[model samples]
Target: MSGSDSAAATSRYSAFLFDMDGTILNSIAAAERIWGVWALRHGLDVASFLPTIHGARAVDTVARLALPGVDPEQEAIGITLAEIADVEGIVEISGAADFLRSLPADKWAVVTSAPRDLAARRMKAAGIPVPAVLVTAEDVAAGKPHPDGYLLAASKLNVDARDCLVFEDAAVGIAAGEAAGATVMVVTATHFHPLASPHPSINSYETMFTEIDSDGLMLLQERGA
Candidate 1:
């Protein structure tokens, strides 16, 4: 990690919050394949539409499009089923599995825009452990770009949202983390394009290390320090 990344390292957090898809795992290929088919069926330009959906609930994304004769809720349900059925391209982000395993199970949570079943299936396929506190779309009335999920995850972990470090990959997820008052770390392991953000950013967890102090506060830093 560079000196510019020290902002996140300087904090002692009680818990860690993570966004699933682009943060800990890469589901973009499978997701875009399915969504592409749906987009073409709806007369949308696949190339342009796919990028807008990451880090957001499928229902929320679909509802925002306002496609004629489309019921957002039903479309989202179908998309979820397809995603669950196809984990062909799903894989962990660089060092994600080992990094997650190192954390105290109760001190971290996954707050995702995906539904619970789909999230579980993807984590299993990627060989990442399903976290103890997994907050899914169904658990919150609203999704990313709203602080509801992250805040709820912190609540479930018995910690303050401000005392957690959030790992996210998309603009919406980052917004959600910040809105929840958590320190945000941008994970770009699965990014398809460059992202510019003021928050500390890392492409992989390979060189990152974590320590838990006597008071149970967790600190994340580059290895070999």
Candidate 2:
């Protein structure tokens, strides 16, 4: 790694905020299946519709593409219900469970654009324990790229937004983290569209480990270090 890259990775923070899907949980397969079916049913192009789905609430996606006179809210609810029942391929991102388990529960949270129930179901399917502070779509008036959810999570954790590190995979979630004044780390573990941010990025948590210092400060480091 370059000097600047190493420097960015070694930076410390008081707390961490994470996006659920694509970051902590690998729900891509399930998401694609559900959204693809939904798109076909709506007479929309699956390829064109999939790009706008991630990192945003289903309701928002529906509102953006639903045909005239289609109830966006109802359509979103149907998608959510279907997603909750469709956990066929849901799994925790590699090393996500270990990384989270090593941290003090109070020092991290999940801020997702999914409804609470759907988020809970996904986590359960992936065998991830529900985080102590979960900011779901229903909890915020605005979704990702709005900063409401991330800000709410930092507030709940009693950590300053500036002292929080955020892990995300989607552009919208990165925007939210940046807007909330947190250092955003893009997770490259999944196949995601390119992001234009200059934040440090990680491809896998598998070779990383967390340590708590004598001062009770936690830091994430590479495994061999």
Question: lDDT (0-100) at residue 67 of candidate 1?
Answer: 85
**Model 1 stretches with alpha carbons more than 4 Å out:** 2-5
Cα lDDT of model 1 overall? 0.93
**Which pairs clash inside model 1?**
none
Candidate 1 residue-wise lDDT at 171: 99
Tens digits of per-residue lDDT for model 1 on 139-189?
Answer: 999888999999999999999999999999999999999999999999988
Q: How accurate is candidate 2 locally (lDDT)?
A: 0.86
Clashing residue pairs, backbone N/CA/C < 3 A, model 2: none
Query: What lDDT tens digits, residue by residue, belong to model 2 across residues 1-225?
Result: 112355446767888899999999899899989999989987898997887899999998888774888998999899999999899999988888887887899989999999999999999999888889999999998888999999999999988888888889998998999899888888877765555557777776788776667765557788665
In order of appearance, the predictions have TM-scores of: 0.97, 0.93
The global C-alpha lDDT for each of the candidates, from Candidate 1 onward, is 0.93, 0.86
Candidate 1, residue 75: lDDT: 99
